[model samples]
Target: RKYGGAIETVLAHLQESEERLKNIETFEERKEELKKILAQQRENYLISAREIHDKRTKAARRFEKEVETNLKAVALEKARFEVRIDAPNAADLQSGNNRRLTAKGFNQIEFYFSANVGESPKPLARVASGGEASRLMLILKTTAKAGDAEKSVVFDEIDVGIGGRVAEAVGLKLKELARTQQVLCVTHQAQIASLADQHFLVEKETVGKKTRVSARDLNEKEKVEEIARMLTGAQITETARKHAKEMLGAAK
Candidate 1:
């Protein structure tokens, strides 16, 4: 009887051990399944991150290349060009997120230039000379028109720093650019203004106590008078008008 009882106890212990081993095996299988799911999710996240990075990098590079090419073509070939992409400030961020957002792909772009051939290019605000800044601004406007097919460009006092041949060059550039865009230039330089397809004059008139602004499109004869006025300041003479006519004819 004792031997039989000992056998029964041994059998019971063996069954208990088997049950525990089965439970452990089941837990390990579940754990392996969880690991596979986590790995898949991580792989998907990596792919998405790579795609975003590639897209952002490509857009930035394209914009940089276009601006650089345009700058070179607009007489700043030796000038260095740079693009700054700064994240939006805290005010621009979402309510709960630290990341800021901007309409221009989370960044803003500013153009910088250097006038001297060997000088390092700096921000547009850093350029101190009035003439250099005017020309730089003109070059940027001209470049923007060249890159687009459906845009119009206007130049107001763009020849402020240029004279002689440089003034003539400015005129030619304006004419060339006008072939692709509508160019309206308000200029004091007869050399520059004479190249316009159509010229309008802005004059101030006193109506009682208040001054009113008036503009008129000049006819051929009136255009001569206006050009003469520009040439001689407030004094228009017969000789000056004739000289203005000659300059206009030469420009054509």
Candidate 2:
């Protein structure tokens, strides 16, 4: 009876070993299946990212051309603008690939500009002047999808480093933009202020020892006089007023 009981115990141990081995095998199979599913998901993501990259490439080409044309309108006639989109380097790919993939897709974008003919295109930080930068920003805004017009867009002295025909162009562009959205522009140039549908003159007032700043909406006569003042500093000459009237009329 002792020998028989010992034999039963041995058989029990053998059965438990076999069961454990089967469980390990089942686990290995499940792990392989999970790996395959993960691989397929990664491949699908990569395919989608490549599709997005292609669409962005096509759009960038068109955007570059249109921005170059707009730059010409802003007096950078020789400027060449480029929208560069490129994939990450091989080193970045080897370091877990996740760094390259973003909500925007698996590519990087940088705006490049050549402000003058015969010059190589460089990043906007290195090449574009203040006026050129402003113009580029304005053009980008113009090209972007229209947003809620109730959102006011303010431009403070964007007309800096520009005057004459370029200033006129900027004013006209602002006016056009204002049709779809509200734009508030602070400019020393009479050209820009003249384009405003409503004009306000900012002044500083001193009462006793305290000085305060005030802005008042100008009437039509006041608007003309303000433009004349902008043209002739503290002096409002007849010629300046006449020129201001002509500018306002022409802007209309």
Candidate 3:
């Protein structure tokens, strides 16, 4: 009785098993198809990577030139800046020697710099001092045209190790940069502060055992007074005030 009632169920399972075995026998055929697809995809990837490499090379040349010019403006006239790009070429990709792929097409970029005359250019991170780094950042950030004006850029102590003419030049460069986008700069130099579209004063107050730090925007008169104080140490001389006024006036 068991064989009579259950024979159909056993036969159904056997049929399903035979279908699975058929699929197993065709596995080698599917593997070959997948291999062909992979080769086609790899060829497309190499072609696209090579195209990206060429565009990067063209842009890097222009970037190097602009950075060199701005370096001169920031009293880094003797400084040399380079945009170095390392990537596999079409020939390298064709030989299947470099099959590694990345999101950015296998291109690596680094900034090289020489801060003094007669010095060979080296990797920027290894050779740049605090002051040189500040100047270089300003040039790179301002000269970069890759993004929109909505991007906010902040520069802290950008005037480090610079004063007098160089400070004023930096202020001018900052002003030019601000014309396109939002820029916030922290500076001790009166020259830079005077050119700001808006100025905020940061003060630290000690209340009992606690210290409170606050920042408040300055009005026009307050801005002038603060600038004058920056020019003169303890006493704000008439000459300093007049000079500060002139600087602000010239900026407008």
| TM-score, every prediction | 0.55, 0.74, 0.80
- Write model 3 residue lDDT over 91-183, tens digit each, in one string: 777777755578778788889999999998999889988778877888887789443488878888688878888899999888888888888
Pitting candidate 1 against candidate 3, the one with the higher TM-score is 3
Q: Which ten residues in a row have the lowest lDDT in candidate 2?
A: 1-10
**Which structure among the candidates has the greatest lDDT?**
3
Model 2 misplacement above 4 A: 1-29, 89-96, 145-150, 204-214, 249-252
lDDT of 3: 0.86
Model 2, span 110-202: residue lDDT tens: 988898889999998988676667677777778664645888887775787778878888888888788888888888888888888988888
Whichever of 1 and 3 has more lDDT, that candidate is 3
RMSD of 3: 4.3
Clashes of each: 0, 0, 0
lDDT of each: 0.67, 0.82, 0.86
Give the lowest summed-lDDT range of ten residues in model 3. Answer: 1-10
Model 1 residue runs over 4 Å out of place are 1-109, 115-120, 125-133, 141-150
TM-score quality measure for candidate 1: 0.55
Report how far residue 96 has shifted in candidate 1, in Å.
18
